[model samples]
Target: MDLIDTHQHLILRDHLGYAWTDTLPALQGDFTPADYARLSHGKGVIGTVFMETGVDDADYQAEARLIAGLVGKGGMLGQIASCRPELDAGFDDWLAECKILSVAGFRRLLHVVPDEMSQPEGFRRNIRKIGAAGYTYDMVFHARQLGLAEALARACPDQPLVLDHCGNPDVAGQGFDAWYRGMQAMAALPHVWLKFSGITVNCAPGTASVALLQPYADAMLALFGPERMIWGGDWPVVNLGVGLPDWIDMSRALLAGLSADEQALIGHQNARKVYRLPA
Candidate 1:
C-alpha cells in the first residue's frame, strides 16, 4: 500500500542549530529532503509530514519556514511545527504564522521538559487554542509519562492529540504490561490517536525484528484500531535502530495478515484524515 509518513524528521544543520545532535554521533549531519527521497525511494512512500527536529528554542520558526519552502518537494505534505504552549505570550500569533505556512499541526517535546510543565493552566489553555485553530497536537513523551499524556488529553478534551512512538514503549526491556495499561487509558479518549513509529529505536541493538515488535504492534492495533492509528518513518532517529527501509519492511510484515484496506488505513488513509492532508 502507498504510505503517508506522519512522523518524518528532516535535519538541515546549515539552516538550523540542533545542540541535541552533538551527543548522538549517528544524527550529527544534515538529513535533507533529497536524502529522504533517496532512502524512501521504491519503499511505497508517497507523502510525508515533516516532523520538527527539536531545534533550539530560538530556531523553531526558522525551522518551520525552512520546511515550508520544501513542502511540495520530495513528497513532503506539510509539517508538525515545534511549539511551547507553556508560554501564553505570542502563542496565537505563532499559530497564525504557521497557518500561513500551512503547517499540519504542532508538537512540544514533553519528554524533555518537567512533568509539571504541561499541568499548568496556561499550558492547557494555549493547547486548547491549537485545537480551536483547527490543528492537531502531537504528544512526544516517555512511556512513564503516559498518565501525564492522558491527563493533558483530558484537560483539553476538544483538541486532537496524537501519542507518538506507541507511547515510546520500553521494548528493549520488555516493559509491556505497564505500557499497555497506559496506552489503554489513552485509547479510551476518542480524540487521541496513536502513531505506529519509533518502536525500533526502543528495542535493543540487532533485536528489532517483526517477531519482537509484533506484540506491541498488536496492542496498538487493538487499542486504536485501524482508523485511529497512523504510520511514520521517524527517519534519521530510526536509523539508530533498523533504519527507514527496514522499519518499513518490518511494519509491512506485521500488518501483512490484515486486509488490504486495513493496511491502507494505517499506512496512509488515517494520516490524511488525522493530519488533515489534502486528498
Candidate 2:
C-alpha cells in the first residue's frame, strides 16, 4: 500500500519566527505546497497533514484560511493549523473560527516554555479547550519535558495528545533511557498517542544509529501498538538532515520487522483515523 505522511509542515520562516527557525540555513526559504508536490511524486505520499508553523499569532485565521483553501483544492491534503493554548481572551471565538474552517488540531511549544508552564492551571485550562472542542493536541517537548506531556494528558482528560519526535530523544550517541521511560509513562495514558517524526533531523549529526531508534519505536508499538501511532515527515524542518525520501527510507528500515497490518497502521491508517483525513 502507498504511505501517507502525517506531520509535514509548510510555512514561511520569517512569518513563523520559530525559536529555531535559523538553526539551519537550508530551511531558510519557503517550503510550499509546490515543493511538497515535487518531492511526493512516486513516493507514495498519497495524503498528508500539515502541522502548525508557529507563525504570526494574529494570523491564525489567515493561516487557517490559507490551509483550507489549499487543501480544498488538493494542494497538499489536510492541515493542523496553529493555535496557542497559552493565550486567553477570545480563544473560544478563535477556536470557533477554526472549527468552521475544519482545522485538524492545535499545538503549543512546550520545550521552550518553563517546566512549570505545563503545571500552570491556566495552561491546563487552555489545553482543556481542545478536548472541549474535540480536537487533538500536538506537544513539542524534549525528553525532560516528557513529564510535562504526561501532566498535559492527565489535565485534558479527553483531548487526544500526540508527542512529537519521540520526545526528541538524546539520540545523539547518548543512551535513550530517559526517552524510553518517558514514552512508557505517556503511552499508559490511553487518550494520548505518539507521533513518529522529526527526531532524525532534529538530532545532532552522527549521534544515533538505526539500532537505537528501534528500541524507542518498539516501546511505543508495544504500548500504544500500531493503532495509536502515526507517520510524519516534519518536512522542511526535516531538511536539516536527510530530505523526505531519506526519512521515508529510514522509516521503512526501522519498521521492517513489524507485521503488515501493524506497518499499515503506523504508515497511514493511524494517521487517517487520528487526524480525521479523507480516506
Candidate 3:
C-alpha cells in the first residue's frame, strides 16, 4: 500500500540553526528532501509531511519557508511548522503566513520546555485559534507529560490534537504500565489522535524489534483504533534506531492481522483526514 508519512523531519544546517543537534552526532548533518526521497525510494512512500527539526528559535520561520520551497518535490505534501503558542503576539499573523505557505499544521516541542509552559490560559487560547484557522496541533511531549497533553486537548475541544510518537512511550526503560495508563487517558479524549512513530528511538540500542515493540503498538492500535492512528517514518531520527525500512517492515508485521482497509486507514487515509491533505 502507498504510505503518507506524517512525521518526517528535514534539517538543512546550511540555512538554519539546530542547537538541539549539537550533542547528538547522529543528527548533526543536513537531512534534505533529496536525501529523504533517495532513502525512501521504492519503500512504498508516496508522500510526506515535514516535521520541524526544533531549529533555534530565530530560524523557525526561515525553516518553514525553506520547507515550503521544497513541498512539491520529494513527495513532500506539507509541513507542521514549529510554533510558540505560549506567546500570543503575532500568532494570528504567523498563522496567516503559514496559510500562504499551505502548511498542514503546527508543533511545539513541549518535551524540551518546562512542564508548565503550556499551562497558561493564553497558550490554550492560541491553540484554539490554530483549529479555528483550519490547522491541526501536534502535541510532542514525553510520556510523563501525557496528562498535561490531555489537559490541553480538553481545554481546546474543537482543536484537533495529534499525539506524536505514540505519546513518546518509555520502551527502553520498560515503563509500560504507566505509559499504558497515560495512553488510556489520552485515548479517552475524542479530539486526540496518536501518531505511530518514534517508538524505535525509545527502545534500547540495537534492541528495537517487532517483538519488543508489539505490546506498545498493540496498546496504541486498540486505544486509538484505526481511524485515529496515523503512520509516520520519523526519518533521520528513526535512523537512530532501526532505520526507515526496518520500521516500515515492523509496522507491516504489527498490522498483518488487520484487514487491508484497516491497515490503509492508519497508513494514509487518516493522515488525509487529520492534516486536511488534498484528495
Candidate 4:
C-alpha cells in the first residue's frame, strides 16, 4: 500500500543549524530530499510532510523556507515548520510568513526544553493564536511529559494536536502500563491525534524488534483507533536502529490484522485530514 509520511525529518548542513546533532551521533550528517527519495522509492511512500530538525532559533525561518520550497521539487506534500510561540515578539508576522510559504503546520521541540516553558501565559496565548489561524501543532514530548501534552491540548481545544512517537514510550525498558494510561487520557480529549512513528528510536538499542513494537502499536490503534492515528517513516531517525525499509515491514507486521481500509486510514488517509494536506 502507498503511504503518506506525516513526520519525516530532513537535514541540510549548509542552510540549517542542527546544533542538537552533536549528541545525536546516529544522525550526524546531511539527509537531503534526494537521500530520502532513494530510500522511499518502491517502499510505497506516495508523499511526505517535512518535519523540522530542531534547528537553532535564528535559523527557524530559513529552515522553513528551504523546506517549503521543496514541496513540489520532489514528492513532498507540505512542511511542519518550526516556531517559538513563547518568544511572543513578531510572532504574528512570522505566522504571516508561514502562510505565505504555505506550510501545513508548526512544531516546537518540547522534549528538549524545560517542562515549565510550555505552561507560561505567553506560550498558551500564542498557541491559541496559531490554532485560530487553522494550523496543527505537533507536540513532541517525552513519555513523562504527557501531563504537559494534556494541558496544552486543553488550553488550545480548537487547535489540532498530534502526539509523536507513541508518547516516546520505553518499550525496551518495559514501560508500557504508564505510557498506555497516558495515551488513554490524552485520547479522551477531542482534538488530539497520535503518530505511529519513532518507536524504534525511543526504545533501548537492540530491543526495537517488530515483536517489541507491536504492543505499543496495538495499544495506539485500540485507544486512538484508525481515524485518530497517522503513520510516518520518521526517515533518517529510523536509520539509527531499524532503517526505513525494515521499519516499514515492522509497521506492517504490527498492524497485520487490520483490514485494507483500516490500514489505509492509519497509513495515509488520516495524515491528509490531520495535516490538511492536498488530495
Candidate 5:
C-alpha cells in the first residue's frame, strides 16, 4: 500500500521540549525520523506530516521552527504545528509566524486540557482566524468530549476541521455505542473530516483485534465516506500500544471491503488534498 502518514511524531528529547513526556515514562526518549524510517521501512510510506508532541508552552515557536525545517526530510511533507489559540491578543502575532512557516495546519491537544479551554470566547475567535487564513485545524478529542468538538466545529463552519483518532473512541472500555452517536452528529456537518488514527492506544489489550475495530471503522466510512476520510500512522504514540507495521496491517484489515480507489483516498489521496500536499 502507498501510504501518506499524516500524524507521525519525531520526538527530539534534547533539541525540543516535551513536557508531556516527563509524565509518561514510556515515551521519554527520542523518536527521530531515521528511527521511524527504519521501523516503517517496508510499510510503504510515501510521505508523512510531522505532528507536534505537546512541547512546553514556551517552546511552541522554537518547536514549530524546528519541525518546519524538517519539511523535505525523509518523506515528510509538512508540519502540523502547536499553537495557543486562547491568547486572544497575542494569537494574531502567533498566527503570523505560522503563516511564515512550512505548515499545513495546527493542533492543540484538547483531550488532555481542561474542557472549558476550548469553549472560551478567545479560543473560538482564534479558530475563526485559522479558517480565515485558509488552514485546516486538527481536533484531538476523546469520545466523551465529542460534544465539545462538535460545538467547536459548528461555531466555525468555514474552517476545515479534521477529527483525529476516529473521535478517539473508547474501543477498550465502553465499546462503540456512545462514540458512534457522537460521530454521526459530527459527520452531519459538511466541513468536518475524520482521521483514522490512534485506535491502538485506546483498545483493550487483546481487543485490538480486527473484529473489535472493524465495526467502528465501518461506521466512520459509512458516515464520513472516502471523500471526508484520511489515515495517519500516529507513530511513537502508536508505540504506546501497537507498533507502526502492526497498525498498518490492522488498518488494511479493517478497510478490507473498501474499493481500491477508496483505499487510496483513505491512505493518501484525501490527505494530499486536505493538507494541500504536492502531487
Candidate 6:
C-alpha cells in the first residue's frame, strides 16, 4: 500500500530551550530527517504529517518553522501544527495567518491541560472558530477525557475531529467498558474520526499483546466503521515497544479479515482525505 503517515512527530530541539525534548531521554533527543528515513525505510511510506509535541509555548513558532522546512526535506507530506485554543482573542487571527503552510489540522494537547480549560465559554468559542476554518482538531485526550470529547464534538458539530490513539485506550489496564462508553458517545457525532494506532507503546512496557487490544480495535471498527477510521504508525513513538515495521505488520494483521476498501481507508484513504495530502 502507498501509505501517508498522518501523525508523525519530529524532534529538533536546540539548547534545552525545548523543555519537552529534555524531559525523557527515551522520547527526547534529536530525530532528524535521517532517523525518520531509516525508520520509514522500505515501508512504502509515500509521505508523512508532523504532529506537535507538548512543549513550552515559546517553542510553537520555532517548531512550526522547522515543520515548514520539511516540505523540501523529503518524506514529510503535511503537518498538524500546534495552537492554544483557549487563547481566543487572537486565535482567529492566528488561524488566518497559519493557512499559508501545508498544515491540515490543529491540536491543543488536552491531556496535559487543566480539566477546567475546556469548560470555559472562550475555549468552546475558539473551538467553533477552528471548525469554522475547516481544520481538523486532533483530540489528544485520555480515557477519562471522553466526556470532553463528547462535549467538543457537540460544540463543533461541523469540525472534523480525529480522536488520537483511540483515546489513548487503557492499554496498561486493558480497561474496555469506560472506553466503550466514551467511544460510543463520541462516535454518535458524525464528524468525529478515531485513529487506530499506538497501542503497543501505550500498554505496560513488558506486557503488550495484539490480542489484548482486540476488543478496543473491534469496538472502533464497529462504532466508527471504516470510513471514519484511519491508521497511524505513530512511528518513532511506537518504537517505544516494537519498531515501525512491526507496528505496520501488526496493524495489517488486525485488519486481515476486512474488505479491501476498508483496509484502504485505514491504511491510506482516510488519512489522505483527512490530511488533504498530495497524491
Per-residue CA lDDT of candidate 1, range 20-46, in tens?
889888897789888888899999999
Residue-by-residue lDDT tens digits, candidate 4, 149-173: 9988898888888888879997767
TM-score of each: 0.98, 0.91, 0.98, 0.97, 0.97, 0.94
RMSD of 1: 0.8
Whole-model Cα lDDT of every candidate shown, in order: 0.91, 0.76, 0.89, 0.86, 0.88, 0.78
TM-score winner between candidates 1 and 2: 1
Tell me the deviation in Å of residue 45 in model 3: 0.5
Q: CA lDDT of 59 in candidate 3?
A: 94
Order of all candidates by TM-score, from best down to worst?
1, 3, 4, 5, 6, 2
Candidates arranged by lDDT, highest first: 1, 3, 5, 4, 6, 2
Give the clash count for each candidate: 0, 2, 0, 0, 0, 0
Prediction 6 TM-score vs. true: 0.94
Deviation from native of the Cα of residue 218 in model 2, angstroms: 2.3
Model 2, range 1-279, lDDT digits (tens) per residue? 457776878866544444456666776778888888788777777787778776655666577777776775543557787776666876788788887676878887678767877787887888888777877788888887788888888878787788888678776746477778888888888888888888786457654346657776777678788788888888877777677877787888888888889888888888778777775
Best-fitting candidate, scored by lDDT: 1
Looking at model 3, which ten-residue stretch has the lowest summed lDDT?
28-37
TM accuracy, model 5: 0.97
Choose 1 or 3, whichever is better by lDDT.
Answer: 1
TM-score of 4: 0.97
| TM-score, structure 3 vs. true | 0.98
lDDT of 3 by residue, 1-279 (tens): 668999899888779898887888888788877788778888888789999888899999989988899887767889999888989888888998998786999999999999999999999999999999999999999999889998888899999999999899888899999999999999999999999899899998999988888888888888989889999999899998988888888889887777999999988999999999877
TM-score of 1: 0.98
